[model samples]
Target: MRKPNAARDQLLHDLRNAYEGGASIRTLVASTGRSYGSIHSMLIESGTPLRGRGGPNHRRRVP
Candidate 1:
């Protein structure tokens, strides 16, 4: 498999910014046409905090 492109990284950064600015995941996904899993993984890799943290199953703090 080829390495991930800069588009993915840039998309992740844009998604992170949109998310932090109060945009919903659904909105971002719809607008960007990116998968939720990909977005989630990007956030994980980029160390971006989840918009809604502290859910029932989420114990990992966003720090």
Candidate 2:
């Protein structure tokens, strides 16, 4: 459980870390009980480069 009223920086750090670690915003929303818009906004606010749709390896590369 997180402390109520956690600092913005701290929350952003956690959100960014989770996102970078391959956890999607939807996953975070489920875990954090926050809305999709809230999660998306925070990721943007934290300057975390958002991933494209369909997640990892959506398309295969020719070798």
Each candidate: what lDDT?
Answer: 0.76, 0.92
Model 1 gets an lDDT of 0.76
Clashes of each: 0, 0
> Which tens-of-lDDT digit does each residue in 1-63 have in candidate 1?
759889977877887888888877777778878887877776777787786643488566988
Q: Which ten-residue region of model 2 has the weakest summed lDDT?
A: 1-10
The residue ranges of model 1 lying beyond 4 angstroms of the native Cα positions read 1-5, 53-63
Distance (Å) between predicted and true CA of 39, model 2?
0.3
TM-score against truth, every candidate: 0.61, 0.76
| C-alpha lDDT of residue 42 in model 1 | 68
Compose the digit string of candidate 2's lDDT tens values, residues 1-63. 645565877999999999999999999999999999999999998899999887475678879
Best by lDDT: 2
TM-score of decoy 2? 0.76
